[model samples]
Target: MNYSIGDFSAITGISIYTLRYYEKESLIIPARKENGRRSYAESDIAWIQFIKRLKDTGMPIREIQKYAKLRAQGVTTMADRMEMLARHRAVLKEEIGKLEEHLSNLDDKITYYRTEIRKCTNLREDRRTAEVSCCT
Candidate 1:
C-alpha cells in the first residue's frame, strides 16, 4: 500500500526532515502523488531500513550514495555491491579485535588489583595477631 510522507516517516521511525534530507542526498526517491506530495510504497520501507543499517554500520554518506547508485543500475552491479559490503565487514572485524584486546587488558588489571588488596589484608591480619600474642 502507498503511504504519504508523514505516514512513511512514522512507520519507518525516521523523522520527516531526515526523509527529506535522504531525498536530497539521492538515498531515496519517493514517488509523487498527483498533488505533488511524496508517496512511499512498501518497497521503500525495505529500502529505507537497509539504508539505515548501512548508516549504523559506519558507512559514509558518499559510500552509501555510491552503493545506492549501483543499486539503481540493476542486477549487473551485484558484484560491486558485494565487494563494498565485504570491505566494510573486514573493517568491522578489525575493530572488534581491538575492542576485545582492550577488554582483556582491563580484566587483567582488575585481577591484579584484587590480588594486591588480598595480600595487604592478609599482612594486616598477621601483624594484629603478633601484637596480641606479645601483649598476652
Candidate 2:
C-alpha cells in the first residue's frame, strides 16, 4: 500500500521536511500522484531507515549520497560498496580505540582521586584524635 508523505513520516519517525530533503538530495525517491502528492512504498520505508543508520554512523551527506548512487547502480557495485563500508569500519575502529584510551585515563584519574580522599580522611581523623587527647 502506498503511504502519504505524512503517513510515511509518522511511520519512519523522520520528519516531513527531512523526507523532502532526502528526496531533494536524491537519497530517496518516492512516487508521486498525477497531482504531485508524494507517496512512499515499503522499499522507501526501508531506505529511510537505512539512511537513518548512515546518519547515525556520522557519515557525511556527500558520502551518503555517493553510497546511494552506488546502490542505485545495482549488484555490480557490491564490491565497491563493500570497500566503502570497510573503510568506514576502519575509521570507526580507530575512533573506538582512541575513546577507549581516554576512558582508561579517566579510570586511572578516578582511582587517584579516591586514594587522595582516603589519605585526607585518615589525616583528619588523626588530627582530631590528638586534639581530643590534649584537651582531656
Candidate 3:
C-alpha cells in the first residue's frame, strides 16, 4: 500500500523536510498522486534506509546521486554500483583502522592513570603506617 508523505516520514524516521530535500536532490523520487501529494511505497522504505546507511557511512550526496542515477538505469548498472560500494567499503575500513588506533591510545592512557593512582594510594598508606609505628 502507498503511504502519504507524513506517514512515510514517520515510518522512515526522516523529517518531512529532509524527504523533500532528498527528492529535490534526485536521491529519491516518490510517486505523485493526482493531487500532487507525494506517495511512498514499501520499496521506497528500503531504498531510503539504504540511503541513510550510505549517508551515515560518509558517502557524499553527489556520490549518492550518482549511485541513484545508476540504480534508475536498472540491472545493466550492477557492476558500476558494485564498484562504487567497493570504494566506499575501502574508505570505511581505513576510517575504522584510525578509530581503533585512537581507542587503543585512550585505553593506554587510562591504564597509566589507574596505575599512577594506585601507586599514590600505596605510598600514602605506607607513610601513615610508618608514622604510627615510630610514634608508638
- lDDT (CA) per prediction: 0.92, 0.88, 0.93
Worst 10 residues of 1 by lDDT: 127-136
Q: Which lDDT tens digits does candidate 3 get at residues 1-136?
A: 9999999999999999999999999999999999999999999999999999999999999999999999999999999999999999999999999999999999999998888777766876878653332222
Using all chains and alpha carbons, the TM-scores for the candidates as numbered come to 0.82, 0.86, 0.92
| Candidate 3 Cα deviation (angstroms), residue 74 | 0.4
Model 3, residue 25: what's the lDDT? 99
Better of 1 and 2 by TM-score: 2
Worst 10 residues of 2 by lDDT: 127-136
TM-score-sorted candidate list, best first: 3, 2, 1
Check candidate 2 and list the clashing pairs: none
Candidate 1 structure, TM-score to reference: 0.82
RMSD of each: 5.5, 4.9, 4.8
- Give the C-alpha miss distance for residue 4 in model 3, angstroms: 0.8
The true-structure Cα RMSD of candidate 2 reads 4.9
Error of 1 at 61 (Å): 0.5
